[model samples]
Target: MKFLKNKITGITIVLIVILVALSPWIIWHFKPDRHLDVLVFDKTVPQNNYREHKGFIWLLNSFKYTKLNGDKYGLLDYFGFFPEPNYKYKIKPLPKDLSKYDLLYVTDTYGVYDRDFYGTSKNIEGERSQKIYGGTQSSEISSIKSALENSNKSKTLIVEFNSLASPTDTKVQKEMDQLLGLKWSGWIGREFKTLNKNNEEIPRWVFRNYRKQYGKEWNFTGSGYVFVKNDDTLMILEKRKDTTKDMTFKFSPKGQEDFGIKREVGYYYWFDIMEKVNNTESIADYTFFLTESGKDKFKKFGIPTSFPAITESKIKNHITYYFSGDYADKGEFPVVYQAVGLPKINSLLISDYGNTDSFFWKIYAPVMQKILDNTYEKKSSETKTASIN
Candidate 1:
């Protein structure tokens, strides 16, 4: 009798400890303060990467609940979360319903993988899969554009990261111009000048030497911030520094020139796309401050850099148009678009654990936070207008 009692007590104690260990999760799961329905579409959601992805999602989710009043938030994962819980997490596969959700969060890489999987795989047929996987197809781009434009509900917002590829062969420069009537220089022969902490101009040659040591071509031109807008409203904020220099023309300079060569310097431009949006203007109204040390480092290294930090008042002002780079180089240059804004979305894009802690995050998160806040405000205003009518 005594042995049986002892065994029962041990089992009970273990059960109580297990419950205590899992208490936080249980509380978080069942006692959400607000209800928010968010959809995440990514192919690697079930892998270890999902944990990091969830960190961002949960950050946003917690912020949403704290800022907005909601008791229930519905989350849908397309690729699913790893360490698959014993309990279902309301997972939905492709072709599932999306109309009921309040917001959709999509990563650009997810779209690319989906296109290759469902669109290229012969196992599936018809245009349905193709439509879902918007690729370099006109129809797909148009479809996505239409969907975004139509999602005007005050409660719905689309937070997209690193997903702004031209749907067809049309470059983003051309597409942005056509879609928003904003003229932008291509990524070449641009110049970027750095300033010291005292706001004094750093010698241009300093950047020149840095570019050389980094094996970058010397063709650089002018570098600065490019602002775009429609009807006096700021739509896009592009802060970039470019370098353009001339070197001796090499044999087959037209094709053999490398990004590091002076001849190629005139042919290629490096750019980083900081923030893009529609309907809002004037990034100046927001408090703008880039880490002074980072700026100083760029100057010390003679690297071209641009930082967009503005006062809250500047954000409300209207911005008309902006330009970045435009140069012609051999096709070997790293795709400027691929390199730009990489750090801004690294948690979702890069597989390496080291990238998350990289400098990109340090500089980008604050900027993204400001942009997201602006977007949320804009969405709220639009919703109010619709509701009033």
Candidate 2:
């Protein structure tokens, strides 16, 4: 009788221990839908290199909730955290219910993978040496296109094709062109000077005109050959003007604005630029911030006075935003990391884990936060999404 009683107590204690161990997962599984369901289509990131890709991975990690172990990730932690975005990282096939997720992030490396992005993958190759993948997989681009098409909430789709090298797959390029309301004109190599903020002449590409965040302004000047042509559905809400005062702020480039916000970003000296096209509008543009000699050289190439640097458009109820460059490059990430307050999480990955801010908070984590803040608004529940079959 004593032996049997002891055995029953031991089993009960073991069962209680197991239940306690699994409680967090159980609570999450049956929990009410309070958090945003964010889906990251992350196949665009290449595995094998750890250092270069660390910044990108750090960005993704910022969206995640860390687990108790702190050093390793369990199954529950792998899916993501609660309260804000319960991010489910999907790489291969698109999820079945297209409308289920609140936000979709496609890295859109096109075909060329960044050597820096290769950095993190190299560090992760201890288990399987042969399984390391570098470039985007086949059919993945088509799958993303299909997802966008099938999703009525396509506006929630956040994508940036970071590569200047056009997709060798013409089909991918064509689909992106039609979808973005601009035709990809390939790459360019040049230098960009700081926008003349105090000159009283508002440069066509000055994007820092937004009211301000935390009572401050920020802008980037990078040379990437990203050219685009507008389609029939284009909307140039505000055409390129020499200078104009819109929204109370006057056009005073040199003497008018804070000096800290206006700086040059000249990586990928030769990059891609775009022209406005169908069903789209240009909100930001490239400035002629060149020296007389540089201007003469650019003119010889027959480049236009200015081109749209930022643009937006709607397709099938989804609103997609496009930019000329990415914030993941080596030159830009450090500054962004400092601005975002994670100064140590760059070039090298930091293992210290904790809960990160929401998407709205972290979205500004990159250089484009200002642009997004002024342009894209959070979608209300009442906002209508297209019905996809």
Candidate 3:
């Protein structure tokens, strides 16, 4: 009977310790919602592709942001995620007025592809199909422009990669470039764990284009990087021969202070090669550890050895940010917005390379959380000043 009593007492003490340790998280989980007014626009939310904007959605939930005139936690103006009941309205148009939104987030403008729409196997397909749908519409770009130009309050704009890439109209893309201080070089690239022809992970078009341009059969089979321009110009950099190490996100000292990220993180996905225009500031850069031969290859193609990973610009009272890579893509994982210390713990456990979750938890979420918090603080201060006046 005494042993039983001691066991029960020990269990109770353990529970108490755990609860004490999680007290801060428990309080945070139940903090009152801030009710931030924001907009999210993504044209590539296909049925099976939830990762495109999953990290963004998780952030929204973390802040308890709500849809306009609604209590829902997510977007009412999203597109391409669901099958359109009416074919005439397949493409979703932007709200007529966006001046009321404190923040505008354009996560993707790449839109739906033939492979995604038709459910084609990810393996190589026939010559590029012309059946892609949706893109950054001219009217949508006009709406964003009007909001920036006419809004009475300070507005913040955030855009991710592929916003000015293929499927988006060139004229509309150029307009966005001017607004956000960007100049797209028309090249997109990604790292492949293996360059073997049988690797289903590699896109078929990349292999086909290289073979056609050089009139040589696909021969190399090793880890490498593949780059393709809008005009089908192909460049491949094999590991060891061209690059000594994987690419990493090298943050500027200012970026580290601003975003509260102190460590370099690996980025192994699609990214664009673009130049910063106007008064844009680079917050971080994609550092490619290329060999001398790799440098020669990039120089031959008129590409730089390194380029901006994140850029920021200020227009009047409005601020805009351009993420040059898939910064918001958090692969399949359960949301844990209420768990405060999980990201810190996870960052310590996960490796920095080839892990999407690590990048999301260690880099993407922290930077975005800092941005949202700072934007809200500034907005609140402005509100208080306006009220006083």
The numbered model that scores best in lDDT is 3
lDDT of 3 at 65: 54
lDDT of 3 at 326: 84
lDDT of 2 by residue, 149-196 (tens): 776443355555443233334565556666678766654323222332
Please say which candidate is ahead in lDDT: 1 or 2.
Answer: 2
The segments of candidate 2 whose C-alpha lies over 4 angstroms from its true place after superposition are: 1-34, 42-97, 110-142, 145-154, 188-271, 330-380, 383-389
Backbone clash total, candidate 3: 0
Q: What does candidate 1's lDDT look like per residue over 1-389, in tens digits?
A: 99999999999999999997766556555643433455444432322234324433434443343334454232234333222343223333333334444444443322322332333332122122232333233333343344445544422322232223323244643453343323222111222232222212322343444455555643334333222111111111112312122211121221122111111111112232333344422232111122455355445533333321111111112112221211111112112211223334453453321221321233223333443454456555766788899
- What lDDT score belongs to each candidate, Candidate 1 first? 0.33, 0.39, 0.78
TM-score for predicted model 1 compared with the true structure: 0.35
Residue pairs in steric clash, candidate 3? none
| Between candidates 2 and 3, the TM-score winner | 3
Decreasing TM-score order of the candidates = 3, 2, 1
For model 3, residues 1-389, the per-residue Cα lDDT tens digits are 99999999999999999998888579766776665677778777545445677668767776555554546454344544344432222555578799888888888877665655565433144335554556677888888889988877888899898788877888988888898898999999988788888777677777778879999988879988889888889999898999888888878887887876768888888899989987898899898888999999998999887898999998778889999988887656555666555556667788888766777778887778778887788788899999999
